[model samples]
Every structure is written in structure tokens, then in C-alpha cells.
Target: LNPEARAFDASFEVLSVEEAVRVTGRYAPLADAVRELIEATILTEVDGGVVDNARAAIEGVTESLRQRTRSAKVSYRVDGRPLPLGNAAVGVCNPIAPPIVVHQEGGGRCWSEFVLGLAYEGPPGLVHGGVSALVLDHMLGEAASEGLSKARFTGTITVKYLRGTPLGPLRSEAWIERHEGVKVFARGTISDAAGVTVEADGVFIEPAWARDGQ
Candidate 1:
């Protein structure tokens, strides 16, 4: 393990990789079901009765789950260790997250492949610009962390949308460009079969907490 990563881990409650997988896996199906429901709600034209029935069922489930809500968020391993189950971008248990699975390639690079359904649609079958930015931001931060071998937070990110990103299968790639002191600079792109549609550059900074631990 990278020394920096190990040091950072010392500051948080670390769970066994198996436990993380099991916990995330337990929720994975629920997330997928919700994703399907979202897409279906957007695309399907149902009667008022059907809509009311669905709404009532969902409300019941929500109330039941609310009874078991945690009082505080747990600080668990995120940066490619086990799984970031609560992450908004790449969490398997997050229903709102696109189906993005990030893979760390050699030489400070990270890649993700995913598909966007109707729930992410904007501008008539195209992906929203903000959604593109969100994906790039997370990808660039992952690259920065991989480059520095430590967790990093987004300092600033600039995204350029070259063309309309269609709502469907897409790929993103990010890599570290350089680092200075506690900041890592990274670049990334979202591409389709034709070519790149979005590009981004970002600076990631080591948080004060992690730096203090070091």
C-alpha cells in the first residue's frame, strides 16, 4: 500500500474489503430497481391510477426506511479502497448515480464506462451539461488521488463541452498532468464512438485533515 494512503486510512474507520462488498452488494439490487423505476417513470405514460399506486408504494417504503436512518455519516474508505458506497458519482448503492465503474489504469490514469438512461436526459435525448461536469469532476479527482497515492478533494475544475453528449453508453478517461506541493493537476475527457464530447482540467488539493495526519 502507498504510505500516504495508509496514513490517511489511519484517520478513518476502516472496514474489511469483504464487509464493504457485502454491504454495498446488499443495496445494489435496490439501487438498480430504483434506477429502472426512474427511467420507466420518464418514458412510460401511465394512467393516474397506476401513478397513484406507485406513489403510495414508494411512500410506504420510504417511511419504513426512514425509521432506520443513521444519525451520522460514517467516514469509511473511499478512494478506490473497497468501495465508496455513499458516493454520488460512482457508488453502486446510489440510485441517482450513473452506472459508472471507474478503473485505475497504470501511470496515474483512471477510466470509467457507463450508460445514462432517460433519467439523465436533457435537450431532447442529450445528456445535461451539468451532468457532464459532474462526471469529469469525479474522474479527475480520482486521477489526482491515484497520482498522489492519497485522497484529494476538488479545488477547482473547468469543463468544456465540445458537442452534445448523447444519453447512452459513454466512456471517460482522466490522468494526472502534474503536482505541486499538495495540489495535483489532472485532465480528463468524456467520449463517445465518434469522438470526444467533453473535456476538463482540474486541481485537487489534499484536505487539511489528511495533511494534518501526515
Candidate 2:
């Protein structure tokens, strides 16, 4: 890590990350708004001409931005982790993320929260099964590496869909169950207002670089 990125105090790092999160998070609502419009258009009785015009307008804007950013990709690192500015998925700071937006609520478990919407829908009004797995995967991996200096990668994960995950506010959690050599055992679940919907178990492995003290 460069000295400049590492020099900030822990408190300053936290605040800086928070500011970045807030600033980058502003785009999420815009994406969400567009998502809602898409869903509405799917069922709307509006004429085809109007829809075509709207689509063209949106495409023009997208193209303009793409051209403006024709340069090479920009990346930032903080506290040894990659910055999440333009991550298409799993980036809480990215507007386009379906963002499971996990937070460490306490010591024993890793908890995350998000509300599924049309953009993540499958099976008509229900959260997609694959999306559920994606959330659990990330939460479980984080749990497996909790309090460790090294990061863990998913070796294998098994998920059981207990019930249909509804499209609304939901929470997921994971905790380390045990460890065997380089592998960490973990379990996690997704829950809605009704109750637990999806459960998962996985083995997460400390990657080679981290284990080698990189």
C-alpha cells in the first residue's frame, strides 16, 4: 500500500470512507428511479411511439456519458481493499448495484440489509433465487474472515431456499461455525418480515497471497 493511502488515522479513514460512500451512493437512487420506470413501462398502456422516444432519450444520455469516460478505468484503494466506486454489482457505493449493503452489526455475526425491488425480481413479485444466493455468499464470506488479518474466498457454498423471498425490506446474517486448516466454515440466512427464507453453509479459504503474508 502507498504511504499516502495508509497514513490516515483510523478515525480519519472511517470518516473518509463514509464520505465516499455517501457521495457515491447518491447515484443509486437515480438507478432505482430508472428501474421503477422500466417496471412501470412493462405494464403501462402508453403508446409505442412515446416509449420509443423515451428510450432513445435515455440511450443518448448513456452514450454521452460513455464517450465522456472513454479514457482508461479509474481505481482507488483504501485500507488495502479496492474502492467500490464503479463496481456494477455488490458495491454499496455504486448507484447501479442491487446492493445487499452489509454492515457488521456485532462481534459474532455479520449482518446485512437491503430491500429488493423490480430490478432484482424473478418469479413475478418475488426476489430471484440467484440474487438470494449472491447476498448470502458475500455475507458468509465476510463472516468467515471476521477479525482475521487475511481475506477469505468462497471455496464452496450450498444454499437452501426455504421460502419465496418477498420483494421488500430484508436482512441477512452469517457467522463462522468452525475452521479447518486454511478453510473456515460458515453459515448464513436471508430473512424477511415473515421469517427466514434462505439458508446457506459454506467453506471459505484464505487465499494464497494473504496466507503467504503479502
Candidate 3:
């Protein structure tokens, strides 16, 4: 089986897909509310009293959450099946993760469609350069691993900014160019309706732990 399909099948052994969806569904609304709060914090022009009240309300929620025991793992999961909760780019349960879902596009390609809001603004209405890099890095790494078929981490990545990436709807695509031994080389681009605004190339390598397992 292809790497991606194998990974999916493996997930079922730990947590059925239906249960995974149910768990994530519970967290999704909370994450969305926090995401909206981020945008409102960036764009809202309310009075000081309103801001103070909002702060107090948020602090109360934070304190309540803190009272609960925290999980040791950085990422959330159901049994051994990993969830993208803490992922910075496309995590549905990560409030700070941009509103994007990266999906495989057959072959070794991966694609994402997303929109950046005021919370991600940089350079007066443009998406932050660092954010672009984060997304590209994630996409390139996904392609390199064939959507997590094999465990890999980025060894090197080079991004070239062709133009300003606007703070709105955008498209990202990445594909594996080739693989050599434990190394995979990939290329990717971020584009708006006008055209490509950022392009990147990266090399990903299997870590020692993963290689040893093989």
C-alpha cells in the first residue's frame, strides 16, 4: 500500500475514524471561538471598558482551564493516533493555526486552500512572511513524507518571495520532486488569484529513530 493509505489504516487500530471525528468535533467550536477572539483583538476598536471586560472574561476561562490537569504530550491524540491539535498551520483544534486544511492531490502532491485574516497581517494588509514560511514548510514536509507515510523532518528549506502575499484567500501546493535513500526533495508554491507570490524548495530526511525502525 502507498504510505498515506497505510498511515490511515494504522490510525484505525488506535482510534476508529468515527471516534476521532467526534473528539475533534467537540474541540472544533472552542478553537473557532478562540480564533475569532484573535481576529477581534486585532481589528476591534471598542472602548477601554469593553476591552477590560473582555480581558476579565477571557482570564476567567483561562483560569478554569488551567485548573484541569494538563496532558504531557505536546500534541493531542486518541490512544496512539496523532491529532493535529497543536499544529501551527492546519490544526483544526489549534486556535492559532491558520484556517487551512492540507489534502493530498494524488501522486506525491499536497494542496491547501485558506484565508488569512487580520490576525496574520504584516506589511499593511499582507500575510506575515514568517507565516508563509510556516505554511510552505509544512506543505513541503508533507510532500516529502508522502503525507506521513514515512517519518521525516525537514533538513533544509529555501523560500523565495516573488511578491507580497495578500491577506485573503490563497492557495498552496507542494509535490515531491525525487527521493534518494532516506532523503526527499520537494518543491512548493503559495499563490493568490494574481499569481505565485512565494515559492520554496526543501529537503527532508528520515530521523535516526525512524531509520533504525526500518
Error of 3 at 48 (Å): 1.5
Model 1 residue 141 lDDT?
82
- The digit string of per-residue lDDT tens for model 2 on 1-214 reads 4333233221212335775667557666666676667667667787889889988998997787676441234455566555544544466445446665556655536787777777678898899998888888878877786723346788999999998999889988899898899999999999998899999999998766566643
User: What lDDT does the true structure give each of the candidates?
Assistant: 0.82, 0.72, 0.83
Residue-level lDDT of model 3, residues 18-116, one tens digit each, is: 877886788788899999999889889999999999999999998987886535433344644456666788788789998578799777899999999
Cα deviation at 161, candidate 1, in Å, is: 0.8
Candidate 3 runs further than 4 Å off:
1-13, 72-81
Write down the lDDT that model 2 would get: 0.72
- Candidate 1 collision pairs: none
* TM-score for all models, in order of appearance: 0.88, 0.78, 0.88
lDDT of 3 at 142: 82
Better of 2 and 3 by lDDT: 3
| Weakest ten-residue segment in model 2 by summed lDDT | 4-13
Q: Candidate 3 versus the native: TM-score?
A: 0.88
lDDT by residue for model 1 over 1-214, one digit each (tens)? 4455465453344777787778777888889998998888878788999999999999999898788754244446644453566567887878999858888897779998899877877799899898899999989988998833576989999999999999899999999999899998999999998999999999999876577764
